[model samples]
Target: MSFPCSDQSIRPRKMQSASLPGVMEAVRCWCGDVCKVKEVTDFSDWLGMKFFMCANYESDPPESISTYVRPPSPPPLCMYYRWIDTEMPDWAVTEIRERGRRAWASLDLEERREKAEAEEKAEQKK
Candidate 1:
């Protein structure tokens, strides 16, 4: 299931290109690298919109690094991209906002539950 944009407690993930439709073709970036389509989950009016971004584009990583099995991918070669879809409708924006709110609320509850359980376990150990 897709999570909300506001709830960043979980890591963001990339949807496989195989599931993408209508964007079939060899779309290349200005840097001559193949571009990948990523969906907008920022919980804004643009939510669910797809865009073609450079495959080499690496967004800013989190400040803390939990583990590093291997070196991360290279940085963005060229900041070139194009939006696949146009402006979203009012109804679509409203729907996306509501969905995002619900998603974050559910995730918040789950996180609180997990934290409480962990605290209880620690108390028991003590």
Candidate 2:
């Protein structure tokens, strides 16, 4: 199926029925703090998935986020989580996995190129 903004496979975000269309509805965590709506942008099958996350939640430090922001994350308060959208279809899952594979491979190539360039610079400095 197709959507006006994105593919049907794209994760949907929960929002207030009465509020603005794009405004996300507030979801409180176990601690009564409003949870943050986050999207999985990493190279994985779950990419583009939207979920509610506790502000104090942490999976593995900086690596948990695709483009991690550095500010010394606070201790996790709770592990509350809820998916906003339904699970993807089999074809959608396969497509996402393939995209993720290509993305990872591209990143590896870029890293290798940068490393080689750095080595060249070091040799020139010697």
Best by lDDT: 1
Question: TM-score winner among the candidates?
Answer: 1
Worst 10 residues of 1 by lDDT: 1-10
**72 in model 1: Cα distance from truth in Å?**
12
Worst 10 residues of 2 by lDDT: 12-21
* Local accuracy of candidate 2 as per-residue lDDT tens digits, 74-114: 66677666666455446558877787899999999999999
TM-score of 2: 0.43
Task: Give the per-residue lDDT of model 1 (tens digit) for 39-71.
Answer: 666556565666666677665455575448546
TM-score each candidate.
0.47, 0.43
**Candidate 1 error regions (>4 Å):** 1-19, 23-26, 63-75, 89-94, 97-126
Candidate 1 collision pairs? none
lDDT, candidate 2, at 54: 64
Model 2 alpha-carbon drift over 4 Å, by segment: 1-24, 62-75, 88-126
The local lDDT score (0 to 100) that residue 4 gets in candidate 1 is: 20
For model 1 the local lDDT of residue 2 reads 27
